[model samples]
Structures are given as structure tokens and as C-alpha cells.
Target: MIDIDATLVNVHSEKEGAAPTFKRGYGFHPLTAWIDHGRAGGGQCAAIMLRAGNAGANTAADHQQIIGQALDQVGLGAPRPRSGP
Candidate 1:
């Protein structure tokens, strides 16, 4: 599991006739992913439930790759503390 800071990106609104918002409602998306032996695999999956019409901002393939790269850069590729003390 990787915790993301939702405020860092732009998201759309799902409600009709409503303006797009940011960092409101649920502020996180849980990705149950694993980078194993130089490969990525996992059965758990989910997405951040935005207001409406927000699906295009981050799709499955793009998001997975983004998160995977971030994890690699932050030393998450190896075993370590997942959270702060």
C-alpha cells in the first residue's frame, strides 16, 4: 500500500453543472500493488472516488506506472519502514 497526497494533482468534478474542486472529500487513493523480483503484480485494486467526470485525470496504466516509479525512487522498492514513526 502506498499513501498519496491528493492535493498535489488536479482532479475533475462528477456532479453535473458543478465546478471542479481540489483536495476535498476523500483525499487519498489506496493502491494495493507489489513490485516483485523486477515485476509488478497484485490482485487488490481501487481508485479514488471523485465527484464526477474525474476518471480521465488518472487512468489505470498511467497511474500504476507513476506510482511504481515514485516508489522506486523513494527506496520503497526494497524493504523498509512504510510509514513514519
Candidate 2:
């Protein structure tokens, strides 16, 4: 399974790619994708997209791209369909 998440970072000073967030705070909004290992153990990170502070939180395109990145990390190609339920 793939887990996607985003968090707002508070920028303290001048920095590249930094901007004013929706909360009126200055920082960045980074979108990340992770592989879920569930009960097996700790998972791995698949991708990270560093977006500006004012970036859209629920953008469909961003989510789609991130999902594709995670799929690429699989390296085994697309999983085959289950033969039976």
C-alpha cells in the first residue's frame, strides 16, 4: 500500500522555494509518498515533492504524480491480477 501525506513547515528566514502559507505563515508544503509494510516492519519512502507554502493541499494532479512515483519504486512492474477471490 502507498501512504501519501503533506505537512506545513514554518520558515524562519529567507529561503529558496519558501512562500506564504494558507495560515499566513511563511514556509514550505512538502508532499510525500511512503510504502506501507503494515505488520511486517518499518516501511520505505517512495517519493517527495517539495511544493511552495501556498500550494494546493487536495490537488488531484499532485496526488496522481505522487502515486505514480510510488509505483515506480515497486520495480517489479504492476502486480498481476488475483486469479480468484
* Model 1 per-residue lDDT tens digits across residues 1-85: 5543233233353434334334444222332333332324332222343223223345555465556655665566564343323
Which candidate has the top score in TM-score?
2
Task: Flag regions of model 2 displaced more than 4 Å.
Answer: 37-41, 76-85
TM-score of 2: 0.80
Record all residue pairs in model 1 with backbone atoms less than 3 Å apart, i.e. clashing: 13-52, 14-51, 14-52
What's the residue-level lDDT of 66 in candidate 2?
82
Q: Write down the TM-score for model 1.
A: 0.27
Q: Which ten contiguous residues of candidate 2 have the minimum total lDDT?
A: 76-85
lDDT (Cα, tens digit) per residue for candidate 2, span 1-85: 8888999998899989999999999999999988985887678989998999999999888987788778878874475443324
Error (Å) of candidate 1 at residue 75 is: 1.0
User: What are the lDDT scores of the predictions, listed in order?
Assistant: 0.41, 0.86
- Cα misplacement distance, residue 63 of candidate 2 (Å): 0.6
Model 1: number of backbone collisions: 3
Clashes of 2: 0
Candidate 2 local Cα displacement, residue 54, angstroms: 0.3
